[model samples]
Target: SAWLGALAYGIMKLFGPITGLFVMRFNNRAALMLGCFLCSVSTLVSSFIVSMEVLYVTYSVMYGIGASLVINCVMVLANSYFDKHLGFATGLVCSGSSIGALVLAPLSHFIIQTFGWRMAFRFFSATFVCVGFLNCCVKPIKRKRKGDYEQDKNNTIENEMSFEAKVSKRPSLFRNRAFILWVIGTAFGMFGYLVPFVHLVSYGVTNGIPVSKCTYFVMVLSGATTIGRLVSGRIVQKGYLNSLHFIQLCMIVIGVLFMILPTITSFAGLLPFIAFLGLVDGCYVVLLPMVTCSLVDYNDAILAWGMLAGTCSLSVTIGPPAAGALFDIYGNYNIAFHAAGAPVICGALILFFIPW
Candidate 1:
């Protein structure tokens, strides 16, 4: 399962940009629906895997296509739904992902223990089918009048100017200097960021921690992320300057959390870390809106967001494996924590210099 997931994730990065760019240019609604279909299909296929290699091929590779498709379209859909409350709306939308993690992580355990892993896969596939059907209900917003169309075009012009001015002033980013740096730093940062959460149970097992007790860490993290989404959204809405800077600040906290994570010896100690990580994770979602707003116009928000997510997904694609590889080499994840802090720090510094 692990290998299959990794294989899927690794290649998904390669295809993400193409899929995202194509969706932005062409029929976005169809693209969005297609993603949902892929997710549903991937889930259905997973139930039939007979070997680890098959698991990797279907769940990892095919499901990756579904995840990538969903993410690209969802960003565009989010932009359409929220104009005044972009940050809050994005936070609300992203909260579902963390909520799913919190609920499904436990539910999967129960299903696997009682029925079988295959049944668990089938259940997830069924859930995606329902979600896809719901997405089909989202009709394209029709411009009813010539005046409305003109107004929309004007809004697009204004937003484009706002973004162009920002980007024009920063030749480094346009020349691809800062963008390249940002991508590299973020990618490296991701490598170490997820290790603690993914390996928390194993770490506990190695320390003779009970399975039940160790599972609580996952719950704590998910709960923290859920709460964090709302809290960070509120904060972003209330504030005015430098959302990217705020993101950097939150990333710093995330880095510190990982750095100190190994010191936690009991559930109580772990609780704060889990919650803090979740809160910071939540802020990252809210930051997407702020970042998009900062870099592009309100009118082109959907396309800009698609590009942003496609770029950042690359970082996510690399982060976990880098952390895993570090563990393999060093026999401890301490170095990984330190490594995760670097990209965030660099990202912070880069945004600090840019005109927000």
Candidate 2:
């Protein structure tokens, strides 16, 4: 299931750029609905698969592609409507993910225990398809006529030229130096970010923590992330800090936390660390969109965000397995945690050197 989740996210990232373009070129509502439908269909199909290869195709590839569209289009829609408070809106949109984690993990766990895993997938498939239906409620934001873009009567020709030049000076998504730095830094930052989510339960079990208690770690992470997203969004919205700087700050803390995660022996000791990680990771998620909004012109937010996600998707796909492989090699999660954290520190350094 863990590998399946990662594979889904990775596939989503792979499809991100194309989905992004679809949203930008057409309507977010339509794109989002398409994604939701595909995901629902894929999830439904997964319930019938009995072989590994079939599971890979149905869940990992098909489901992943659909999920990616949903993730990509949601942000694009958020950015489209909320310009000044884009961070706040994005935070709210991303908070839905945390909330889903908080509720669904436990519910799915319970369902698997009570019935069977296939039933759980079937249940979620129904829910996901319902969401696709709900997407029909979204209405497009009415754009103004082209005449609204005409020069003001009070403006001189030279002033109009200057304004045009200034607007044009804001580089396109591919050409923006700050955006490139953001992508590069975020890629490295992602390399170790998923380690805790994937390994924490097993690591705790090995150290004698009860499965029941360790399971709530997911809740803890989700709760903290919920709070962190709201707070980080507000910070960016209010201009308290640049989105990139806030992201780097979170990464620095996350890096240090990963290094310390393996040293704790008690189940109780793990709580605070996991909570803190959740908060920081939540902030990281919200800031990713905020940073994209900050770096690009408003018209290009969706495209830039898609590209950014696509870039980081490479690291997202590789990070967990890389950490797991280290665990196999070293016989302890100590090296894995440390290894996961090291690149984030470097990613932060890269962000620090880049003049946004």
Candidate 3:
């Protein structure tokens, strides 16, 4: 089950760059509609699957591709619509994922238990169709035409120079120092980002916490994450701190929290740690696109995001299993937690040294 989940996640991230190309070739609305169609059809087909192999094809690959397209399009559109208040707008948009997880988790559980897993998937299919309808509400941004630039005779030379510079520097996206640091730092941070989410409950159980109470840790984390997303966005919008600096601080805090997580033996002690980690994690997530926008040209934001996602895929895929392997060797989660914290801290330090 863990391997399957990882495969699904990995596949989704692997297709991030492709999704970017799709958006660039077509348009946001088309990409979104296509994503919605893929997701709806994949889920509907998954409902009738009888074999694990078929499940992988329908649930992992197809569903993952659809999800990647949807996510990238949303980020690109959010960036396009709001510039001045981009942070808050991104937070508002990304928070929906956490909200959906909170709402659908139990609802899906109820449906699966009451009816069956097939019914649960069918419900998901219907939900995606509803989401497709909502996608139609977003108007596509009108691209500027070459003739439009010709009408501005006074700034024609300047516009031409700017366009030439952009074309010439297009390849610099991969070579830019700031972007390189950002990607490295983000990759390291992501390496261990999902460790706690995957292992926290099991860790609590091993420490003798009641299974029922341990489950609430995730809920608490999710709720705190929602608050963190909103608060972080507001902070960025208000210009209280640089978004990159804020992201670095969040990474450091999360790293420290993970390192100290194993020291807490009781359920009550773990709640505060989980909540704070989730809060910082949430801040990091929403700031991703905001910071990506700052680091690259507006035209390249989506592609940069896609590149970042693809680069982090390996780290995210192996992080949890690596932690699990450590547990197998050490007979406890202490080393695993420490291992998780190390990369995040290193990633923060890498960011701290960014020239910009």
lDDT of each: 0.67, 0.82, 0.85
- Candidate 3 C-alpha lDDT tens digits along 1-356: 55656787898788888887677666788888888989999999999989888889888888888888898778757787786777888998888888888888778889999999899989999999999999898788855533556656844554556544644646757887899899999998888878978999999999999888987887888888998898899999999999989998988898888889989989888998888888888898898888887898776778788888888999999999999999999999999999999899889999976777
For model 2, residues 132-178, the per-residue Cα lDDT tens digits are 88888888774533353563453344344553464365456767887
The window of 10 residues in a row where model 3 has the poorest summed lDDT is 158-167
Cα RMSD for candidates in order: 5.2, 5.0, 3.7
Give the range where candidate 2 is weakest over 10 consecutive residues by summed lDDT. Answer: 151-160
Compose the digit string of candidate 1's lDDT tens values, residues 259-355: 7776776766666767777778878766755565446444344444454555666677677677778878988767766676666555555555544
Candidate 1 global lDDT: 0.67
Give the residue spans of candidate 2 off by over 4 A.
Answer: 1-3, 142-172
lDDT of residue 79 for candidate 1: 60
TM-score of each: 0.82, 0.89, 0.92
User: Which prediction has more favorable TM-score, 2 or 3?
Assistant: 3
lDDT of 2 at 58: 91
